[model samples]
Target: MEVAMRKKIRRIITILGTTAMIFTVTACGNRMDTMQPAASYVADFFDIPDTVTGIERLLLKDDMAYLCCLEEDGTSYLAAMDIDDGKFLKQNLDLDASVSLLDFGFAPDNSNWAVCLEKAGGYSLRKFDNSGSQVQSVDLAGVMDSPVISAVGRDLFLSIDMEGNICVAAKGGNTLVYLFDNNGRFLFSLDYEGNLMTTTTTAEGKIGICATSSDRMNYDLLTVDMETQDWSKDKICLGATAGLYGGVNKDFYRFDSSVLYGYAAGAQEGIPVFNWSDMGLGTSEVQLGECTDGRFVVLTASSNQTEVLSYEMAVLTEGVDERELLSMVSLTATPGLVQAVSDFNKTNDRYKVELTEYFPYAQNVSNEEWDNAILNLNTRIISGDMPDILDMSNLSVQIYQSKGLLEDLYPYMENDPEIRTEDYFENVFEAISLDGKLPYLTDGVAISTMLAGADVVDGNNGWTIQDLEKVLDTYGANSINNLSGASFLKIMLQTDGSFIDWNLGKCSFDSPEFVKMLEFAGKIQESSQDGCGGTEMSDTYAEAYEEVLSV
Candidate 1:
């Protein structure tokens, strides 16, 4: 059997003004390290209002940037600025208790900008002219229960196609998108059972909104007839864009509903290849300024500052010597971690880390389902289709090490100047080390602490079993029943005796000391099972006994 050696590398890429980088990887060969800037427009900087505390929504139309900025007093104002010179033309419309700005765009050949504001279980479709004057306002009150429905105006899109002026705003949480005309007339709505990713126009000049199912796999473009308000669905040949948290791309050039359409190299091509590769050069929910003379502006804002990035769309559409390869990385997905990975990828184009999923629907999975997914992934690893990163937080590092699947990372850490052992939290190296060999690397450390109602024991520096027993006695018999299964296990481990001998991978649960721990567990179980001390259990002893036995 041939053992394949996998190299895990960590490299930092500097991003400043359209930097293009390349990294070549192949089996049994030298990896070329090259860095070059691409032929894209350089980034331009601008300053927003010093009092501007937060950005509620952003939109760009006809070379002008529209921003809904929240002031330090929590008041939102609609502001407009020139994309070319970053000059604030005008603003003063105050909108309070605003939830989200749904859709913002221009009417067909109209200079006025229409925006939908969500607030207090209602939808306010307001139109503002170039000078920020409110010309029209329509309120759809009682759309949802305010307290119950926290997220309003989650997705807002307006498209003016050959069909008619159409507006799409999320009515419910991943449930529906209400449609309307340019005059704030409620046309119709489509029952969309997914999170809206983006809105694009079909080549035939039709309006379409791209959405992903709850599983984040189904990418469906829901189109609506602007004339008749009729809705239709066509499945696009691409995996769902990583919602708002995940950076998404625009699909601007596809007309035929029968043909597969995807964004490749900044152009819509007839390809259905599901590229889970991350270019890192992308955006979340951003405002695209008017495209004029083959160039466009990207406006992005945070709480304190705003930035404008100019780009030559034509240059982007054309091929450059640099290539952005999508590097696939598999990890247990969480919002914070996903955003972190997204930010890291955007830092440099040399390597884009795309996260692969063990299952199509990773969220809201049962423990049994998660176990099965891991089992399936382990089988894949056995067949040599291992992911670049294992994300051992969700899997057993010991099992991988025992199977000779995990490589020792100590040498890599030692040789890499970027990584320093002293920078990590105490005991991390010892905890992740197996047989004097490091097998796992965690992004961060989790500190464990105990919460007690009124201290009864000296547990500050750590206490012994006798100290714990005194604490329990002080709290009385009811405390034992309140202890969860995990708490019971922790106490036993902290008290004394080892469950497993790491070298032999064998547990010593049958030993006399282990029996004492089991007896303590039984005492608590009996109290709860017998309905003593105001505690009750269906089958406490059986459940508790099985928990210990499994360990």
Candidate 2:
């Protein structure tokens, strides 16, 4: 029996906005060249690496950073990197010869061709196996590199080019986005959109965010699909637009729950905290009255007894109930090359609770019980009444993705191909099997790993403010989402956007317009600029053009 080549590469497409480019693939005898790893490649610029011999191009991918090398048999292989420890792992593929590529990308699972590259040479596409071997082939003539490749899913690629852009040659291809290349050339684009997005640029492939603008613009955010060249318009507000003085988009002044929050590193006494994300103009429990990066002052009614807490949109990764990752490092011991890992991670706390479990109720349950139990189960799951892990032997827990319950475990799988490729037994790893003969039961439960809280957390009983001081006072340690020090993330916690319906992916941020109502109370803080906001900001008259007249 012949051994199958590993890491097979099928097609490679080059994508980018180029000054000029060309794709020229010629059919000649394979140019047998030894492949070695190049020290480095352009992260964004066209810079080359130094001091390397065994690979053609170095590929830095989303799941794993890898170096491309050639096997003795002429197939390509990728040397993987361990992000936690920063070590190189060499993965090889089986092939006879005749595979050369300029650009490529490793998918989340370290598998090849989660994307296609737009190259300057003939159809610059490369496909590889898990072991880093070429498994497939696609040849096209006169290709250019002005292309964008986005693979938010498996086996699908969205590639956009400046030109000779990716044209849908076959049927079932017309349904994609298209665009004109830079310098006024028409090109085809494709649809491959996802709720979440990220980009990359490399010889294995590259992606960039490009836009055109005028001196005076009305709407500024333009989203161009690299694969389709299709575009969408957005106002592009980085959350709250609190003018220049401490807004969400700005650095220090972060808004949370429409309240302006700040840290006082300089003040000799105490500090005041407010929902910085909401930067209202007044002094209220839910409003940000007076705050500063270095000075915070809290003002409250003498009648109030309860202290208001900085509310979080969701339970944080470091909440009281969340598990913490233990550190294994030692101070006195001579540090070994190998690093020890701890399981007690306390940071997996960012959860809307209900939204994650509700969507899968139908998929994991059978049709006989799908409808009847789905709603109840979803409600139970979101309500936090369910166990951390669910028994799915008789239950069918399909990996429903439309809702944000699942984390596209693809990235984790890409980092560990062998772990995700095999059948998941009971949601647990096959190698880490629990019982016998139960592939379904062998899988790891989502609840077991995630610190999923009770669903009631997202309900209308959101947050109640009794005393205004807990949230606004400079002394309060637990800000929204359990922030201790000055944190930008606290702002993400302070909005109606923070509370979400896990089942439907519904969030409260831009909702029932009550969020604006909450904002109504908040504008009191930012707009004040008075003594109430803080002593520093207390009505200070700027020196007029004619200062002598003031005397």
Candidate 3:
């Protein structure tokens, strides 16, 4: 039945919506005086077909763009496009039910290609040598139970390192990666814990698998040693796999969120040495074009269209020069804070900081009205509308950190003569460190502790959040009324399950721990028949909310 379905779907069917962009990076010599445009148009008004309801997967290989789409009738189609001239190629296939393209990569011989297709409950390997013809096909249903098949998404990934070996990563059963040669022969499979985000090859013949967890809270970069079948894993501090782009050189350059991380790709120990950092705030959330000759193009999506941006990047050998005049810009919703900075600017001659008010709508608006205002602020920041030295209160540290936007302040603190790290409390300092390095500065600290009645919960005895939950689970809904919002929030803050990490700049507020906190709070609200009987704490927290709650 499966082979019949595959034959039935593998026809010359072009089911619409195919678009492509060809991006090339250019290397330029230093004149530094000529202004460089951050981005420019490679192509415009280019899009998929009108009939295509949704895009299931997008892949770029050998300057060609392949997209899998699902029609309104629940059927799937694979479309190909020429990235150079926005030309639609003559290859489209109707995919069987529950079958979709996972990933595609160049075969070892460079003359053929392989595509990973997921069927109802299995996978298949398809080879195309004519660029429009499938030369061979094989079913992977039995192998789908292997640990390498345990991925979390419908999309699979195929990549080749410098040595021309192939890597296929999938995410449904258990996020696993399989190694192979150019001949469609399986090498071996390895158990990978996270969603396969990207695969990189070093200057040598090393394959790097970059994967992340479902919640975007954990990440791993693994390198496989083929001959010995040895693999090593490196934990990535960045939380989400979103907005990550990079290519290999002498090292692998990864652009995550807003920062560029240079990982020494040739390490045998699997841990890539952090070489350099790029503070290109302008590159935030922009999809990188192909890396060529030290220049690259970026595509940014807005509204219903795509905008292109170009850049001239310096490679590892480029020299640097110090600037005389330093200018910084910031966007903020707080007027008083802006005015304070303006006052300082008036007195200082060495530096001039310009502040732009982000949300005028935030003024004279209720708390409910500020929701969209905050979203707007986030959109602007991600679009490279950033100011140096941003205030974190209005911005998301996790989002920025995941993008490599926020600078690690530990090095800065060490160099500054006047700033003493010891001045801050230990826990407060630790709170701001994600990977054990200070990425941001906090003005003060907020503490969370439990507040429960002697009759409601057992002896305090330094009861943790887990203990409180266990007690609640043992009792009925009546116990929830005794807990307040402040108390619940405090418990989350104190709990190890609070997934927000400032250093990494990622937060899983929707994590199980946070959900439990909200569920408890919801029970309290739900049990209040009149919604007026629950005790509410509404006073200025002079000392600490945790201290007050505990008392």
Candidate 4:
């Protein structure tokens, strides 16, 4: 039944016109001036199908690009596109309810490919020829019998080497790399210490796995020869922390920010092959696959002004020009800021905002990865290599201000004729001011409010601590709705900002007024524990409101 449904889904073939944009990045002598446009490479952009919801993996086989795409109906299929003509073909594979597609890769010969699937009992490996026909299916439960497989969870990596040998790797508690022959026969498994960073297969049929030391300060690349069945480990120094982009012959690509670096199998250093910054492209969520012809296939998904995500496919070849880059760094990409930067670049020719996100959107971000990224950002700031603009949404602005790393924005606002002090809310500026100086500006503000019956406070819209105390005394604490200690404290903190004095760098938490508020909250908590507080209005308030209505 599953195979029949897969065959049914493969009956449809739709041809749509693809959108393409040719962009160039040029290099100038030994120094690449980011502000000036120089000659480098050309980029061709294409539109992905609207029905394709997500791309699990992208592979380039000769002139064709294959993508394992998930559709809106929650089914997975393979879509092939002719790179030159922009023609697309969709074919669904035999995936049932009991199994899920984990990862897929193509053989070096471009004549066949394979997918790794996770099932209830264990895992399965399915192989298919270039024509999309199944050639072999092997159950990997017995083959992957090591206890490390169960300990590593399910973060799996699959690839096919030059000699059509299959390699699968799992990373978590430890790193395990398994090698298998093309005939679905198990060969050998290599174990390595530390966390696995990435894995790649070179043209010489050698599988390379990069892992970080326990301290995370050192990196090592383990290379395994499929035929010889011998492996070697060597320390390597990379230009920047990067993820592997697979291998094209002897050279493999590593992606960091908007730059793509190419390195030989055993080389310590990699040279930049493509820089999306040179073409004024935002690197928010990008996936790259290298072609055999020295070109690249890039898949990028970005949110528009309406907050709708759109995907684009681009081909990067040798020839384009650079643009003036205004660099910006942030922990994650915010939709509004990304849209604003894209709009500014479209309208202005002199400058473009290059936003670099340390932690892009992911299902799960390990605590170690988050901490390392934060440390990296702090190191850059301390070394005076920070970007032109820093998104302080996820950062501590007060700490930066204390260190005198932030600049005062009040002077600039005062000199600008368009921005008048009277035009905006004065309190908004006062709220964030540090030491009587405005260091940052916000686009909008959120107001926290509490709603009450006008008759309860005699039509008064404002209330002080004395007024609150009088009301509580008159109606009893249970007359309020679910005003427990935790709720009361939350409301006070949200509605009041007087606790922290930004200008003086002090907090009034120890003051008598704050102490009194805490005591009042504690009384409410005790009442709640005694069964006097609830979600609904108490009988006292209900009876009083009924009497008023009768009058």
Candidate 5:
């Protein structure tokens, strides 16, 4: 509030943690100077909850994270955690029969979870609530006919061989498909994964599933329509490999509005395992910073330690490492909610939504609400009203500049480079060359950012950390304005920057692990390429460990 109070609080914080000492010095008409703070300014973090156990996967909705974990006594449990506070709110459970959890079924309200019993040699998929109350289940004895089980909306779906069947049953252990309404009343089965299960709706209303089959590949690429289910093939695998249909043909890294993204893997060479796009479905995909979607996409690489893909603008599109991004939302729920699916779906279309409902990233809001927002925006746009949601990313800002939404900084920079350098916008600023002229206007990525994330000032090629560090020190040290000195320090301290850059489209490989594997693979490559005219293929490789006989 007051200057003295602010200074006192800053001093106390410095004593507690690493606080940068910021000294302001003003010169007449020359420029302002700020003394660099030696320490970093990491936000004071609060204590997190300790009750969580076996939280292997979490799907955050609004502020709640629907979590699944193996409990203390070797039982599977689904619980809700408050993301902000890390508080364990509640859990939903159905049958506690087997010791292993196979899958969690999808419904409008909550979900159904499947537990497999090997002794029985099959699974009994049950609808359970957050409290572990069982609402319904399939009898394992007879369910052997169709072992594969998946949930679409409120209906239970089963796949025997290549075909899909719908199942619904009351509070009993029985195997059935195509239940009448939400009750266990058997209506009919389909020759394929339920007809409604595929091509049933858009990315909104009905869920769409695409399942393609391949006899060669060990796994399949099961495309879950972000909406409901449009279509799904039985043996489809991602990053395409040859199969029954001609050959794998699709861009491994592609994104459209309806499709949003697709991967036809069998494209390109040396870049076979190239991680790309934000909506990736791989285990190694990096977190592309954090999203409002609650779950963060880990960046296989980062620049300036702040935003992802912070390297200079180039044709080489930085790829995101898609590890945590492949998460499914609302894994499990109470069986009562599953049991009540019939009335709920019929009662209100609003209640029937996708698995990840209302998540911030791919938020599943009511079409009515979404349409209302869109319409309101249109009305405002036509009526000369300002924008409501204004979070346009760095790339979007470039477009905004073209549209004349940004202020031209040419005069300011030209008048006084010393004074102008003090107030750089958020994130990295990309300087655009105007008609092959001198340093012109620049576009900022954030309120403030490092120069490494920005374009090259010297040679104008390659993202060199040395150049970046130098520019940041200049900006961070000399500017009276807020300098993102903390970003550089944080990245250096918290991460392996060299490894990060390798993954950030610099090294031209998936990761250092992949690179090391390739280097190791070079030794074996000679032997493996005997068919490729290697002449003499070496079959041996260096090993760090040798397990000898027991002495």
Candidate 6:
């Protein structure tokens, strides 16, 4: 098989040309003024145990921190720690590796807590006493249908009312919420349509759920009576920019860029609880829980490559020489960027970078939502409220550059003593440069190439549209490779230098060459049914290419 593959690759290299593409980390040259630094609202940082490799859920009640922790060996357990002394109180009730924990929370009476886990059969509701001892385990396989269980979504919520009644809500094709008595007996179920936004249990033991409306513009707050199995819903407008963070006992927290607001049941107005800027935290992946004494506990995770390296817990009091705030915006708050901002804030006393994620929950958003977010960002830029830095990975650089919104970094690079053009890859700078101006600076570059055999192209290193057509005609439609039209177009666009004339600030997409390429791509896509082009080269193929390149 290896020898056959090598022969096929060598034949193909005769027809295609090598293409190199670069991906970059872009940063603008905008800095805000520095302000006087004062103490932050963070009371203290608590040290967590080394045994706790990851924290899935963190809850605070009665000055105790309850965490559903995972170990290095993939086993998980419930842990409790004293907030004041940062001492471990209990670390018991271990779960098997096969059981996947969905959510965990405390009972309203504070007597015990429970973790909702999903296993092979279905869901398991395991109750634990305050001392972290296993009290009761309820298997919910018989209650919910297999189809519903299989299609269960990640927006699951487990809430315990004042009477110790358990409510398990899973959002899938339909939002199905189940209620169980203290003894684990199934009580009632509430089936609703639309996506689940947030869930909360009121002080009166009523379970409240906020779900999206059919129009997707408003929210429907559904409050269920656990005792009577009756429910009522009210439609509320949460604005275009407001996002439901989470819900506590009686209040559901919604946030924008800076402020987190709390809304009570059936109330359209929200009260400002706290501002993220005042907390001195950079990332928005914060977990906020209210304590019994009216204080709030904030949990933030220090992560690397999406893995939790450590967890930091701080207390948010009732309320900074305000550090000069450098606002940075991105669609998603990547783990590396979050870690860098946290480190910068820790070391710098004058200025702090505040990351504002327009779509923090990017995984669950729709295309319309993305468009709306981009529109909002464009509006902000037009209004002169633009952020100091913009992560342009998902944005169009050409439009920004054409509109004169981006500043050229060439002057800054020339003036800075630390920046030397000789130390970096000069070709990359030239490739991305627009009319001798560098609009942004990148930390790295990536290369992508496509190899063609010299024999197919008359031993020429490069070929034009006519040459590609002749080769295609000779080899038949499926000869080049079984790449889809879209995939082929993307590669061609990246490699074609004539398509975009950066010097003239124009594009030749409507040219005859581009049209011909599109026609060829369409023909190839239609001829290949499976679209299995072996687009990615294997390790053996790469090794062979290295040998071929050396010649």
Q: TM-score: which candidate is best?
A: 6
| Residue 228 lDDT (model 2) | 42
Over 1-551, each residue of candidate 3 has an lDDT whose tens digit, in order, gives 21111110111110011111111111111111212223221112244454555443344556655554445665565666555455654354333456665555554465434455565555677766644556767676555564444444455666676566777766654457777766667778887656666665544456767777554444556678777775754444443233444453435545433223444554322222121111111222233433333333333222222333221111122233232222233222232233334344434545543333332211233344456656765575566654555655544455666667667777777899998878756655564566775656643333333445565445545555456556546664444343455544544454342476656556787776678767765655554334224344333111111222100
Q: Indicate the TM-score of model 4.
A: 0.60
lDDT (Cα) of model 2: 0.26
- lDDT for position 498 in model 5: 38
lDDT of 5 by residue, 1-551 (tens): 31221111111011101211111111111111212122211111112133322333333345454544444445655555454444565454544446455334334454444434433444455556544677776554353244343332123332111112223221112222332223333334322321221111111222223222232212233333212332234323332221111111222222111112223433222122111221221112111111243132221112123332221101112232222211111111111122122123223423231112111221223445544654553354345433311222111223333333334444545597475544643122232322232222221111112222222245554333444334435543222122122322332232222343322334334665545534433333332322112122122311111111111
Give the 10-residue window scoring lowest on summed lDDT in candidate 2: 334-343
lDDT of every predicted structure (CA atoms): 0.46, 0.26, 0.46, 0.60, 0.29, 0.60
lDDT by residue (1-551, candidate 4, tens digit) is: 21111110101110110110111111111211233212256566677777776676677776888887766665667788777766778865655644556667776555454545565546777877666667778887887764656665436777777777888888866677888887768899887776786676654456677776555544556677665676664445543344666667435676655456677767887765644554434454556677777677777665442454566777767763356766677665444444455556545667766656665322124556667878888887777675766766545566777777777788878899888988877776776677898767664444322234566668765555566566668767655444456656755664354697655787779978789888877765664432223323444451111100100
Question: How good is model 6 by TM-score?
Answer: 0.68
Give a tens-digit lDDT track for model 6, residues 1-551: 21111110111111134311212233444442223222234445676666666666667766887776666776666677677777775465545658766677677545554545565546777876765567788877888776776676435677776677877877776578888887778898988786776565654456666677665544666777764686664545554323453445436666544456677767887666654544544343456666656566666655443564566677665434367877777665443444566666656778877666664322335566667888988877776766777766556666787777777778878999998999877775776677788766553443333344545546665545566557567766555543456666765675456788655778877888888888877776775434334454342221011112211
Clashes of 4: 14
Ranking by TM-score: 6, 1, 4, 3, 5, 2
**C-alpha RMSD by candidate, in order:** 11.0, 28.8, 19.7, 13.3, 23.0, 9.1
TM-score of 5: 0.29
**Could you tell which candidate, 4 or 5, scores higher by TM-score?**
4
Please tell me which model should have the higher TM-score, number 2 or number 4. Answer: 4
Evaluate model 1: give its TM-score: 0.61
Better of 5 and 6 by TM-score: 6
Per-candidate TM-score against the hidden true structure: 0.61, 0.21, 0.44, 0.60, 0.29, 0.68
